[model samples]
Target: MNAASPKPVLEMRGIAKSFPGVKALEGVDLTLYPGQVTALIGENGAGKSTLVKILTGVYQPDGGTIVLDGTPVLFPTAEAAMDAGVSAIHQETVLFDELSVVENIFVGHQLTNRFGLLDWPAMRARTRAIMANIDPDIDPDTRLKDLGIARKHLVAIARALSVEATKIVIMDEPTAALSYKEVEDLYEIVERLKGQGKAILFISHKFEEIFRIADRYTVFRDGKPVGDGLVAEADTNKLISMMVGRTVEHIFPKIEVAPGGTVLEVQGLSHPTEFADISFSLRKGEILGFYGLVGAGRSEVMQALFGVTHPSAGTIRIEGKTIQPRTPIQAIDAGIVYVPEERGRQGAVTALPIFQNITLPSLARISRHGFLDLAKEFEITRHYAARLDLRASNLSQDVGTLSGGNQQKVVIGKWLATEPKVIILDEPTKGIDVGSKSAVHGFMSELASQGLSVIMVSSELPEILGMADRIVVMREGRIAGTFDRSAVDAEELVRHATGNTAKEAA
Candidate 1:
């Protein structure tokens, strides 16, 4: 530590929290110094969210002390925490889309005139001033919905700054959905915030972002603090070990398999505004990777192939037979299935039971002569559920109640029940813990070994590099490049995906 460096502005010691049948946190400690960014990292169930909630006053710690500037304090509510100069911008922006940017910035604490009327002019001017520090182009009078995701995030930060006394800012996964340039813009804003002497608590799963922005690091595992130190002293392997409690030897467990004849072939696939002239072929037992940036039309192409969206012009061939599917059911019937990107919304029916979700795609096969077969349903569900190592209270347990990893397994199991020839997985490991991600990777390898053709669409380059035999890079609705796994590196793949090197790499 530097001799002239400031002391921590906030200190959390011996924090403990629990819910029924689960101890979310135990004896956790975090220290945030002024003008520094501290990253809080862990696997999905590792108590990071619980600790953040406690810090934000959404949950009072079961045991511990929060010391601010050498004095113990308690924040009984979210407003109390904010009043005490702590504010958080969550993963999802919590702003009213119907309201204007100015109204959102000063929602609950609007400035009023001496006559107790809303001070519209003062609010607008103040909003503009605050936004200028982040992005000068944003209009205070525009509706929140009119702005893009990155601007909405700026508005959230502007709302935080509007507090006037916000000494500490908690940004939770702020760049999860942002484009590359938007992420760079946010990094600039963070630097400005630090320059203004605000302590920052940054939470993110992406190690690249953490290494880029954080000065200090604190890692959690199994509800307790395992390590804390300067980011300069930590490497990716060390951080992954701290989070997962073991050396993860391989994150992508891809198994080599001799591919058979083409199972699915697409020719001239086009979706008006989404994508165009997409063509690819998936061989039996092969893993084909789709690599791209956030809006490079990767997911759109996969969705079209699964019949979620009709292609304006295309030809789809399964085996040697030409087929055109107008709906998901028709795609499934033709031996094609898709596990969607937003698993919570499109992959599984959260309200339904685990077994029900698993057997959802194969209901007709499990049903008897125009009648439902409960026994057959349970049998089919249990089979794939075991294959995927799905952990839940029971098959009857609500899928919504399971952890993200388990829920994802249920989604995969649901589709596997169909016994499809081609499976398209869009961002399969997104928002999942490392252990779960390893398990999912193992399962993918197993499926390929069993002669199932897989198409993985991912923005994460490491995932694509580690698992794919061949990668197709997309840029702005078109295939920019194609590469063999042995011949291309991440830099080359990224260059192709960003159109920096538009020609095929190999």
Candidate 2:
């Protein structure tokens, strides 16, 4: 609603899309004005991605009209959309590893000279110019794989800008994997784009990021537009209500319990390059929270404790028994289970049936004389599935077909079958919907109440403050501070996590 903003460069009206069993989008509308960032926000399955796909020509809307610059248009293919001045930079980079940075920026539309041959020099110069506009120091001739994740993202944005006629650019969850500094860099680049008179569609679940860069706001829920307005006029609570259709009463659902004896203890744990001298203790029926920024080594320490990585120097004791686990199977055998952050890759086998995924870790216990017991597997799967309130057509359905929250439940269910004494969850509710997050949090509380010690590794401050009985903040591979739940303060936790100040507590 900025009066200085130009008219809308692109508009979608009455967009509706559906599959056999799903209505992905229903009559959703959006307008993108030049020199403004319009944030598209919603839960995991709230049709944000569906709308992006429609605009990028990934899926044709069953019903809708797309207008650009006072003219109606239909993009039958992704290439057609780009040629018509609409480009999208997805969450995952689409660059080839073998290609150089210059080649990646102009891969699809290469430059040609008068002789009709590939003009490598011209492309390299153009790539350099684009890189200068963003980072100035990124080498255009470097291979794509040599750059870090942040630089790779920069290349993606530069690629979008390389299009001569690009008027609208869609960035979908661009900062999901970025570090704090990387996120700042992205915000700077977004501002530069806005200055260039380009309309940007910024899709993100992080409200902080939305407030940082977005000028306009739109909220979607269950495939329909629920709210749309200027960012200046909206607050986080208002946006949350719009996204979930109700006020989320208890996001964390933490339950108070008297701490019992120590279930797991780590002393002087060290990894060569990841973490150093990390130590913590988890009591029975307690939720221990590990808080840090991305790459602060929280996940690395969890990975080491879970046997995904070995510590160079450390002692791990479970229930007062010293043990060293060399592999994940060893950790599982010792009654320690991990729910990894990347659920799709490390947690569940998407192509496998839901029952199979749940029972995969505990197959040894359910089998008879080395032969699989199908009935036992089904029974165990049903027990945990029902406990977690997992939703699916049937237990035989592929795990890939479920939503993000359900898939996370399936991962947790698989580990719960082991009946581990201690469970480590890395970013447990990440990328899940609000309702699903509440369910997951409630399940964690239930697990703790049942005398299971939980170690939750998360970058979200609210989750740490809300759910933790004892919070440990990490900074650059070391324990910076620790505080009891009753003494928790957001500013203090953030200060420790970012190394602004260290206040180690008893």
- Alpha-carbon shift of residue 489 in model 2 (angstroms): 2.1
lDDT for each residue of candidate 1 in 212-248, tens digit (9 for 90 to 100): 9999999999899999999988999999999998998
The TM-scores of all predictions, comma-separated, are 0.90, 0.92
Candidate 2 regions with alpha-carbon error over 4 angstroms = 1-5, 94-104, 112-118, 132-138, 141-155, 502-506
lDDT of 2 at 154: 80
Which 10 consecutive residues of model 1 have the lowest summed lDDT? 1-10
Q: What is the lDDT of residue 215 in candidate 2?
A: 95
lDDT of 2 at 111: 93
Model 2 Cα shift for residue 124 (angstroms)? 4.0
Q: List the residue pairs that clash in candidate 1.
A: none
